[model samples]
Target: MSGIYIHIPFCKQACHYCDFHFSTSLKKKDEMVLALAKEIELRKNEFENDVVETIYFGGGTPSILEISDIKLLIDTVYSNYKVVGNPEITIEANPDDLSPSLSFRRNLFEELKAIGVNRLSIGIQSFFEDDLQLMNRAHNADEAKRCLEFATQYFDNISIDLIYGMPNMSNEKWLQNIETALSFNVPHISSYALTVEPKTALKKLIQTGKIDEPKDEVAQEHFQVLVDKLSENGFIHYELSNFGKENYFSKNNSAYWLGKKYIGIGPSAHSFNGTSRSWNISNNSIYLKSIAENKLPSETEILSKNDRYNEYVMTGLRTIWGISLDKVEKEFGTDFLEYLLKQSEKFIADDLLYLDEKILKPTSKGKFLCDGIASDLFLLNLE
Candidate 1:
């Protein structure tokens, strides 16, 4: 099974730490929506033989659009692509858009359910006012609580995103954030450390000494707190940054980790088959103009054997499905397998990684350093 990712490249306001491609202005929103629908139809044959199991709407903020606009995009996909009978449909929403009055929220929730949206990934970031201000989020702490309360009444499968390890975020504050998220009874939580992307406002502030840089040790501490608390609460640390209860794991992201084929539509979106990957233009106007001219403005790259092997190791090490030596030998031949085993000896000796039968997994101490270990295990070239 395959998946489809729809990128909505617009937001109500810019978050200080965000580096995702988006426009705060809605001047071209209508045109962009039409372009997205056209692009879906234009690329329909790419997944002709595969049935779509998940349809994910992710972006600057998908909740900004009207339900009708969302339905239009969903209908376009249905008309052009072969989808499963009960596909998992998810939309990423910000708290501000979902913090309307009770009546309005009920109507919105019903409309979404009627249109086949089975899951909601809410961006709550934090429950403290200071943390929200630090991130320059549009929603206040009260709105964050209110939206989740209203959402729980209507949706059973909900996930919330939280940010930890801010510049001044103390351990107490981080624990409070975790407890508040737990109070919401969300089945899934996707949390990440606050990284200062190069061009984001957070980086500029740090460079200018207006704000202190985030500490790696502090982030490592926060990550452990997150893992421990979530596990204590019966959540599975299925991925490095994701925790879910029972069957609530994100099917869309899991498919990606497994290296399944998916078609990404809209500006700044990415698509991957087994051997190649492609990304669309990031500019909104340029994407619209190109679609109007019946052209796909994108770039594609063919993956070499080393590139594929390195990617497999990186994604595998981060998830519960650790790297498989037998699969490596089967897919990349015995030479690749031998190289992987040889390079893994040091880490294995150091207790950072362990072997269970033919599968290799990261130890508890190695979880935070999985990416670095995966990099060390990479074959730079076939030579």
Candidate 2:
């Protein structure tokens, strides 16, 4: 019912489009790892709920850490928290982090498995050299392809990330990307349409005319291709960008979509309970110093009724479960819920939404524009 996310805010290199809080230098890796353990101990009982079903090691790149560091984290969690038996523990990895030869360094994967990391989310942004160059991702195309072959030998619950709608990426290339993922037999695949996030190097490049501006129309086309090809390959379009085969979906991510409470550790990580949201300072040095001083370094916000409604719309509309009219009415009053249902009517008529009993789910056609539609339905207090 509850989960924990620890952000390892360090990467070997910064990708152009990445805006996540990470230091390219590994100088603080040892100190940061220690700080994470200390923080975990400090906030051990923060989860009022006793059941912890998922633990996710996310961020800059968890795979960059030594096996001992990962083990130390797992030990800390098990010792300090009430981890459920057989909890889903995931580590985010990059292709370059994994060994190229399957037979070589076999102990690395075994050691990780022994330490209870039951899942791996590998960042294989693209399987093309040109795309890798554009993103400035550390791994080459071949490394991306080979790492999965090795991973499948040791891990079954594997999720690979891919980027679509790269400049000059045709429909044929997009299809090939999906086909490449299928060939790896990866149980879960997450594909995202590249966006020029604010303050990211990608945005700067575009502004400086070093890179072409991304086209929304091209992104939309690739997204459609992603959904269609994955569905045809027997992958369920569970979330907007996530496709999973059978029961291979990510438990941690699914919890977020379901509005479940979670505690996030480390800098720039966000935590949400049913009522309020909190986030840590994005600066690593500040976070470390604060935690070292036995201070919980985070800013807290209590959600207003309108804020809660907006969050519900944003998270719910992005998933397969969608927003529930009955739940909304119960939580946000009949008037607000009525207005939401009324707003959805036009979308439903336009084949962008579907009404199933008391539920309002987005159609496949609406998935790409989910955020925009959800924002449109947000309850803004004009008064």
Candidate 3:
């Protein structure tokens, strides 16, 4: 089974810490939507052997779209692609866009479900007004709570996104957010420690002395809190930033962690087949103009074996599943596999890694510093 990811690069307002590709202006929403529809048609033939199992609409905020726009995009995928029956279709929505009495919102969910969107990933970064305002998020605490209540009727497979480690957030408040999500019985929760990315508003605020820079100590403490709280609630820490109860793990994201092939469409969107990776240009107008001319608007890269192995190490080491030496030997050859084991020996001795049979996995103590550990294991040069 394969997956499809469509990027809807538009948002009503920019969050302070967000550096994702998006525009606050809606001038080209219609044009971009149309372009995305056509782009889906152009790339459908690329997934030759697999039936599409998951379709994720991710971006600045997919919830902001009109029902007609969503339907048009969905129709294009169905017409051009061999989408599997009962595909796990997901749309990333924001809380402010959901309203209980809005017929448009209700119909949007119904129509999307009718067209096979079975999951909803709502961007409810925080449920506290102060925290929400601090991050310049569009939704208030009340709307964030109500959105989930409104969504529960139509969709059971729901996930909420939360952020921690903002300057205004305290440990007590951070844990409270986790409690609130659990109280609502959310099946999946993706929590992340806030980082001020360069070129984002938060970064500028820090540079200008408008706000204090985020403390890494605070973020590290909160990360542990998240792990403890979620684990206590029976949510598996499946990936570095994801927690899911039972079988509610994100199939689309899991495809990425397992190095599965998927198509990505829209400006700044990324796609991967087994051998190569490609991404659309981040500029909006360029994407619209090119797709209108029936031209594909993406840059491609073919992966060398070493490049692919490093990617495998980067993605695999972050998960609950440890890197398997046997799989490495089979796929990457005995020499590369031996090199991986030799490199892992130091971290293993330092209690940062654990090996069972032939599989090497990170210990919980090693997870926080996983990036450093993974980077050290990369082959300087590989054939």
For model 3, how does the per-residue alpha-carbon lDDT over 106-142 read when each residue is reduced to its tens digit? 7767876886778999989888998898799998998
Could you give the candidate ranking by TM-score, starting with the highest? Answer: 1, 2, 3
Tens-digit per-residue lDDT, 106-139, candidate 2: 7778888988999999999988898898999999
Q: What are the RMSDs of all candidates, in order?
A: 0.8, 1.3, 1.4
The C-alpha TM-scores of every prediction are 0.99, 0.97, 0.97
Query: What is the C-alpha lDDT profile of model 1 across 1-383, one tens digit per residue?
Result: 99999999999988999999999999999898999999999999899899999999999899999999899999999999999999999999999899778788889999999999999999999999988998999999999999999999999999999998898788888999999999989999999999999999998999999889999999999999999999999999988889999999999999999999999999999999999999999999899999999999999999999999999999989999999999999999899999999999999999999999899999888998999999999998774
Candidate 1 segments whose C-alpha is farther than 4 A from its true place: none
**TM-score head-to-head 1 vs 3, winner:** 1
Residue 42 in candidate 1, Cα distance off native in Å: 0.6
By TM-score, the better pick of 1 and 2 is 1
Q: Is candidate 1 or candidate 2 better by lDDT?
A: 1
